[model samples]
Target: MSEFGRENPQFYLTAPTACPYLPGKYERKVFTHLVGEKASALNDILTQGGFRRSQNIAYRPACEACKACVSVRVRVDEFQPSRTFRRIIKRNADLIGEELPPQPSADQYALFRDYLDMRHAEGGMAEMTVLDYAMMVEDTHVETRVIEYRRRGPDSGIRGRGRGPLIAVALTDVLSDGLSMVYSFFDPDMADRSLGTFMILDHIERARKAGLPYVYLGYWVKGSPKMGYKIRFAPQEHLTGTGWLRVEGEDDAQD
Candidate 1:
């Protein structure tokens, strides 16, 4: 093959695995590697086409006779926070998000461990060691960032950065069109503050300021409680056969 032909990504299909979100269902994926000098541009195209990034791979669900996983993106310009979402934002107002390089830290790992232990004890990532967490943070060829949420320090306003203990972290990919949240974790102790929802809200604001029109939120699986909060971010669009269809409210969202 020519250099150009060799550089083209070859897709692969994964063996079926038990679905993490849905009970008694198997999930399979069709994936491709996101590497080489073209990775960033390729990431943008793949993300827009409903594939999600994991390390150096881009994948989307390809299970036969099942389509529960629906890719969704928030419409930045049209988004209006609901009363509960507004409360989540206010509850987290004391926190400030600092965008940093995709480098892992001991503090982040500690919080990640705590989150998994408390919230996802039986989940697939429960056994992930520090090294695995590090790879999750750093193993990427795409344009990526690690956002650390921490309590505002005395000089935060002057420095434009937060200080003190880390409360949450989001692994995000900066795409040509929007910010794609690859993965995220938070301190389980702060669950009442709804840190997950807060992060998405924060990303929406960040995208708005940067003139980006969407915040890609991966998949929103119907009937999965774990995926329900996603649909609450109204004025969002769901990837469908006819392209992205706008869903204005929770009731409007469909499988």
Candidate 2:
């Protein structure tokens, strides 16, 4: 029996596969299902232990010989944006992000599809159907929200939401200690806006506004070019064998 009044979570190791982040390396994962009444609580615990949630599953790197996937979380209250990050925010000023319930829509799927085609056509999620996209958003038992970014309309300030076509979307989870960015995608045409980085900056601000201490940014591989952007946020903490340790670097200036 386990703490949730059932058998203990049965963990499984995934078969080794080509590492997505590094060339000539393989990767594996330890995963378990997040289900039932205790799913939310279990998710929080697993996440704190460095696991990332995808739909109804929580998984973490269990690679045989590689430890490149280090978990990272931004110190929301202590974060200071770089000049480059500030520029990204300024460039996206016309967009507004509205946090809505985890309900999928045709419009969102369209944007998701376009993003996949343009950015991740060779990735795993590129083949996902509309149904799969909806399941990703609505399958969770934990507290989750979808933040949709769009162009601000005339009534935006009054309603606190934007109108026009959806340009980006972020699937997030509200953990007891932080906000976990489950997944996010944007219109590839708007790459110049740096919407990806802007979304993270916004999430940090959102976490600060909600009195959260951290904003989980999932894994950051040290040598992976694709993951280098995560390190730009200052005063972040990286999970280590001992515990979560604050990373000190050139970007440590206080805001």
Candidate 3:
């Protein structure tokens, strides 16, 4: 029996599929639905145990003969922005993040499509339709928020929200201890702004202000270039056999 309640959540295993990060490796996942009244509690527990929530499902890597995928979370209070990170913050100083309910919009889908087409044309979600994207955003039982980043406008102070077109978007979950970044995408054309790093930095600040201790950053795969950026956030903890082991210093990966 699991710790959640008298009846344990039923788990399902996914068939082996080509690993998106590492070549010559296959990946499998053990997943369970995140539903019912206890969903938020279950989400918090599972995430602390290294499970990542997608839509209404919470999943973890259960690949056979491999253990490269590691869960990571940033220590919000202790994290100080590096010189490069500082520049990224200053670079996007005009931008503001507005947290909205988990609702989808055509504008968001357009930006999402552009991001996928440019950054991940060959990725698994490349073919996701607008309706599919809606499900991805709205299909959740836990406390979820869709944060849209855009440029600050003239009346920004009064409105408390950004104006103009959306520049980036992040799907986040509010956990008892931290914020989990389920998914995020930005305008590929604004790559110079380093929006990805900016979003993480923003989340850390947001979590800190919310009195959260950590910012769950999903997984960081060893030797995978796509996941290398995750190691840049210092004072982060990696989920290991002995539980979350804290790591210091930042990896110098290309910005």
Top TM-score prediction, candidate number: 3
lDDT of 2: 0.90
With candidate 3 superimposed using the best TM-score fit, by how many Å does residue 136's alpha carbon deviate from the native?
A: 0.1
Task: Pull out the clashing pairs in model 2.
Answer: none
Q: Which order, best to worst by lDDT? A: 3, 1, 2
Clashes of each: 0, 0, 0
Each candidate structure's TM-score, on Cα atoms with residue i matched to residue i, is 0.95, 0.94, 0.96
For model 1, the stretches where C-alpha displacement exceeds 4 angstroms are 1-6, 251-255
Candidates ranked, most accurate by TM-score first: 3, 1, 2
lDDT of each: 0.90, 0.90, 0.94
lDDT digits (tens) for residues 1-255 of candidate 1:
346633898899999999999989999999988888888998999898999999999999999979999999999999998777788788888999989999999999999999999999999999999999999999999889999999998988887689888899999999989999999999999778889888999999999999999999999988898887788888999999889999865833321
> What lDDT is reached at residue 151 by model 3?
94
Locate the minimum summed-lDDT window of 10 residues in model 3. 1-10
Clashes of 2: 0
lDDT measured at residue 232 in model 3 versus the true structure, 0 to 100: 95
Q: Candidate 3's residue-wise lDDT over 138-230, tens digit each? A: 999999999999999998778879989999999999999999999999999999999999999999999999999999999999889899899
**Candidates' RMSD to native:** 2.4, 3.0, 2.4
